[model samples]
Target: MALMITDECINCDVCEPECPNGAISQGDEIYQIDPGKCTECVGHFDEPQCQQVCPVDCIPHDPGHQETREQLMEKFIRLTASK
Candidate 1:
């Protein structure tokens, strides 16, 4: 599943740099995670890098954007291929 930044985010600026896919960005309020670009680090790491680095622990799996491991891997491949 793609990960999302919760309201509890402190805008610490740590998670943005941790996202390998560049999915995290500054939003009007806190930070935002683009589900389309988020693979939860499936192809890059065992755990979501952003979640690992976030100081506030605001990142969590997005139930609305759920996907299996295979699907996340497919997304990773697709993203990498385009770049």
Candidate 2:
């Protein structure tokens, strides 16, 4: 599943740079994770980098954007190929 930044995000500005996929960005209120661009760090790291550095613990698996490991890997591949 893609990770989501909840409303609880404190805008610490830490998580945004931690996202390897560049999925997190500043929204009107808080940091937002683009589901289409998110891979939960599948091709980049063993764990989501954003989640590790977020002080608020607001980053969580997006159940609404669920995907299996294989699916996430495919998404990661697509993202990298475009770069």
Candidate 3:
């Protein structure tokens, strides 16, 4: 599943650089995650890098963009192939 940054985000700027998919970006107030680009670090790491670095633990699964583990891996492959 994809992850999202909650309103609890302090904008500390740590999570943005940790996203392997470049899905995190500075929003109008807090950071935002692009569900289409997020793969929960499936092919890159065992855990989500952004979640690992977020100080406030504000990152959580995006229910609206839910996908299975295999789907996430497919997304990872597609993203890297395009690069």
The TM-score obtained by model 2 is 0.97
| Ten-residue region with minimum lDDT total, candidate 2 | 15-24
Candidate 1 residue lDDT tens string, 1-70: 8889999999889888888899999999999999999999999999899988888888989999999999
Instruction: List residue ranges in candidate 3 displaced over 4 A.
Output: none
lDDT of 3 by residue, 2-76 (tens): 999999999999998888899999999999999989999999999999989888899999989989999999999
Pairs of colliding residues, candidate 1:
none
Model 2 Cα lDDT, one tens digit per residue, 10-61: 8999988888888999999999999999999998999999989988899999
TM-score of 1: 0.97
Q: List candidate 2 stretches off by more than 4 Å.
A: none
Error of 3 at 83 (Å): 1.3
lDDT at position 78, candidate 2: 95
Q: What are the runs in model 1 whose C-alpha is more than 4 Å off? A: none
| TM-score, cand. 3 | 0.97
